[model samples]
Target: MIIKPMIRSNMCINAHPIGCAKETENQINYVIAQKAKRGTKTLAEGGKAPRTVLVLGCSTGYGLASRITAAFEYGADTIGVSFEKQPTQVKGGTPGWYNNMAFDKAAEKAGLKTKTFNADAYSDECRAEVIKQLKDWGAKADLVIYSLASPVRTDPDTKVMYRSVIKPINQVYSGASLDMMTGKITQASTQPAEGDEIPNTVKVMGGEDWERWIKQLSEADVLADGCRTLAYSYIGPSLSHPIYRDGTIGEAKKDLEKRAHNIDAALKAKGGAAYVSVNKGLITRSSSVIPIITQYLGVLFKIMKKQGTHEGCIEQMERLFAERLYTADGKVPVDSENRIRMDDWEMDPKVQDEVNKVMPAVTEENVNELVDLDGIRHDFLIINGFDVDGVDYNKEVTDMSKIEY
Candidate 1:
């Protein structure tokens, strides 16, 4: 069946099998191109950079990119845990399902071992299964990457579904934002978190799950020596800070950062460390649903592209593994909060100065002239394997993907 992007609320509801394959191939090609970066090199030049990695939420976005980097670049054995919906003949599976399937196929060809678990990452059953797999492999991870983006989570014990909210915690926020779906600049306001909004947001997006993962991995003895973990976070410019950085989500991030310290201390005896990696804001599915951030992202993407600093999930992960997390000299540079700052280029004083000027000027009339909504849309599409080049969109996918969950 011919498939196209069916997007709503910043998410693509359907995916093309062939396009997803092509997208996965593209990322693998990128890893092959950057052979001298983080991947293994011949002993004559340097040496193999071998690792064992476990990635939670390793289906799409940064998690998928990180898996590719580990296996293709560093020749690492990897196990992935994610909550994803697979495709069927009646309907296209989530892009993540196809991506993960394609990744396993490619890894097999490359003689790399990869295992994926499609289940709620918050469930004890899933956690136990992942740990069991790690034990069987006897290749415990040297690094663990947390990139979960679920809106709600089910409590394993209580079976209660807790949904996360996106709201300012202190005051109602009004700002300029782009409608990624329509390419229209719209003014939006977000109300402050009330009642259980703050706590629920923390319960879902905070570092509790991450900390639990660490504890379980440690108890299971599935974490290799010097094993470190990192979770993704974001802190944008002042214009959107009230609804972003210093808002409800920001409170969760702060708690995550604080947990990093505790996790670090807990793992110190085993030579492990934990960190909150503050990343650049891109057109992620999660970010697209936020208030007043889409406009900033569109504008920022345009400026960053012009400045030769545009980066997507793959670029960001590549730099993180190659430079910040793993370097020839063995150093991990961090911000004052001890968080890894991959937003350096995006937050370049010059970039922020330009963004500040552009944020207030954005309006429906001036949206096109001021920002690159197309660029933002391109990002959102590419991440989901939609609108990809060299992929036949007209082909029937009834037999293309035999993926089942």
Candidate 2:
């Protein structure tokens, strides 16, 4: 059957099987090319790199890019955990399912060891299985990446599920929301969190799960000496703080950042380290739904592309490994806050000034001129395996359960 994107309220609810696989292969090919351009050597070549990596939330966005870079560029054996719906013959699954399948297939072709789990990362059973698999292989993870982006999470002990919200803190947040499909702009506003919403948001999106994963892995002795763990975060410009950095989600990020300190102290005893990498804002599944972000990213993308500093998920993860995480002198550079600032280019003074100048002037008439509407539309479509290059959407998907990468 031929598949097309079914989008509602800026969310793509359906995915294409072959398109997802092709996009995953595209990222792998990109990293392979960068290995030569950047002189990236694998551990087999006596280079400093991760030997065995574990990536939580490893299906899409930054997590998938991290896995691809670790396996393709650093030549690391990887175990990935993410919750995704599997496809059947009549219907397609989530984009992540096909992405994982493609990643596993490509890894096998490259002779890199890989195991992907379609299980919830928040459950204890999933943790136990990962630990058992690590023991079975007798491989300790040298790099652990936490990049989970879920709307709800169940507490492994209490059996209570908590859902996260994207609301402001104390005041009503009103911002311009851009419709990527139609180029229409509308005012979107959300009230402050009340009752258990703030804590619940924290419960779902905060650092508790991250801390638990690390503690369990350390106890099970599955973490290698001098191991490094990283979690991804984003802090856009002040314009987006009301709906992002200063919102309920911001409270969760602060908790995650705080836990990084405790985790860092514990890991330091083993010569290991922990950090919260403040990454750039990009068109992500979750980011697409947030207020003011779509418009902000539209303007940001236009200016950054003009400046020749635009980076998608793959490019960002590649630089994280080649420049920040693995330096030649064994020193990982960071900002004064003890965090790696990957959004440096996006937050540059000149870029923000340009964005500030252009955002207010954006209307239906000048929308295309002011923002990279086409660029963001392409990003939004490709994230769900639609509008990707070199893929014939008219072809039939003979089997939904499998893909040829």
Candidate 3:
């Protein structure tokens, strides 16, 4: 079957395998070219690397970029766990599935150790599988990265499925938003969450899963001495606080941040540490669907690009590891909330002022020329293997869904 992008509601249901592979390669290349602009030479010209590293949600966005950086930057052996759909005769696999396949193939060609578990990362069985992989590889992980982002999570013990809400709290949130499906800026609003929305969102997106992973890994003795773990989170500027920072997802993020201390103490007992990194806003499948975020990002991207302060997934993760997390003295600098703030650039006063000036004035007519809609839109599509540079769209793409990784 020939694959073409079928998009709806800021999501592309279909993905091109070749384009997916190409996108994956592009991310990998960014890490490999350490001598380029903002050249990060953390690794001693690729002398030594991490013995073992595990990344949950290692398929898309920063999670996938982290995986590539771990292998390509630090030369670390990696094991990934993610829940992604396999393609069928009539459907295309989730972009992550193809990305993992491409990553594994590339790792093999480069003679790098890489393994992936295509299962629910929130399950006991998946944890067991990771522990088994660690034991089989004869190396406990020195680094563990949790980058899980799911709309729903099933409790392993109670077998209860909780879906997370992204609604604002207290009152309806109205703001300018960029419609990703079309090149238009529009007014977007989200009603305050209903009963149990906050609790449910926390239950689904909170740090329970991160704690579970750390606990299970610690119990299995898969964490090396002085091991470091980090999970991705977001705290955009005040513009998106209603639907992001102070909204349902914000409640979930608060829970996640609170758990960091617990995990840090737990890991400290084993000569290890854990943290939550509040990341910069970028166009991702998850964030694009959120209310009023794309418009914010559109304005943000334009400002940051002009200021030469823009950082994508690879750049952020690269900096996190090279400059922040694993520094010369091993001291990780964090904010007052006891979490790393990679969104520092985004939260800068100058940048926020620029965003605020143009946010309220955003309209369908001027959004294209005024903001970075083209750049933001392309990032969304390229992640799912559409609108990619140098990808042959005219050629027939064979619908070979599964690749043994």
Candidate 4:
């Protein structure tokens, strides 16, 4: 098999209107096909459909999945808030804005209302704008999903700069492989986490922002009664613990998990709830860049794929909505650690045991049998609609300045 070039661009950058639109259409079509395949009931009956939804960071990854869930499964009128940049036609354009446009087009076709706010969710001005828009629509959101991942955030009170980072927990001497051509992983080495990086990483990736979003929303009275909110997280196998769970990012996730309790208490007064779902590991743009984990992910994907239990962001989000979030009991289940155990299934003992046996011997020659590096990279490309079947990649994409929201 031939390896394609990997595209390394800015995260949370400008979006291409047409490409995003095509992506939105594609997701809607995929969801419709999936629903038909599963024969699940739509959320229309008994007035269970989400009437109003707010998705922060709705341009990519889990945020986009939540938006798709609202529109496709529950038939909700949605508002997506993101700091999406408008791409210049000269450079390779941004994808999120076009994705927004595409999603809007699908919503129109489905007879559901949709809007997008292209602004920083951390800014007071942007928050006010979203609140005003909600008031204008007279729609308090029944579900709010916070999925923002940024490097810097200002304290609402002190106005201090807080920069996020990813480091190991202990002194790590791990081996990692990279694809110099596409920046894709072909191999890697394993090691232990360093000590100092944990707190700093936790400070960055933890649940402070998530809690802040919920507090502001509740204060604004935009969260409807019985409202449910969720944030995405990940916990992989022991092989990845040093670089993942037991590492700096893991410490931050621990902070996030702790914040869930505070949020749950805050929302309980209003009959609302908050949850942090520890999702299965996949080749997200974010995950693919982490140390050592990339090769592990490639290997894990190969194992899970052979087992026929692999899932991407869409699959994870779809499951989170239908099975976890919108379930009949209205309670978000979690493990003893106060973390949802979504990844546990993916890293089952039997599965991990088998993968662990093969992990030590995995190299470029045997990687294909031990891991799904191709699949991982393929999903990464698909996030931007590259390698998507039936789509004309060379088509001249039109510029879309703004999405109405």
| Most lDDT-accurate candidate | 2
Q: Is candidate 1 or candidate 4 better by TM-score?
A: 1
- Whichever of 3 and 4 has more TM-score, that candidate is 3
Model 1, C-alpha of 11: deviation from truth (Å): 3.7
Query: Residue 35 error for model 4, in Å?
Result: 3.8
Task: Give the per-residue lDDT of model 4 (tens digit) for 19-95.
Answer: 45555666676667666665545556553446788898898877887799778877788999887556553444456
Per-model C-alpha lDDT, please? 0.82, 0.93, 0.85, 0.70
lDDT of 2 by residue, 1-405 (tens): 787889999999999888899999999999999999988999999888999999999999999999999999999999999999988888789999999999999999999999999999999999999999899989999999999999999999999999999999999999888999999999998899998999999999899999999999999999999999999999899998997899999999999999999999999999999999999999988888888899999999999999999999999999999999889998989988789999999999999999999988999899999889999999999888899899999998888877863
Give lDDT tens digits, candidate 1, residues 195-265. Answer: 99888888888998899988888888888888889999988788777887788788888888989899999
* Per-model TM against the reference: 0.94, 0.99, 0.94, 0.87
What TM-score would candidate 3 get against the native? Answer: 0.94
Which clashing pairs does model 3 show?
Answer: none
- Which portions of model 3 miss their true places by more than 4 Å? 35-49, 402-405
**What's the C-alpha lDDT at position 211 in model 4?**
85
Q: Candidate 2 — which residues are off by over 4 angstroms?
A: none
Off by over 4 Å in 4: 1-20, 37-44, 178-200, 329-331, 394-405
Q: Which candidate is the best by TM-score?
A: 2
Instruction: Note each model's CA RMSD in angstroms.
Output: 2.4, 0.8, 2.3, 4.1
Which digits, one per residue and each the tens of the lDDT, describe model 3 over residues 145-168? Answer: 999988899999999999998899
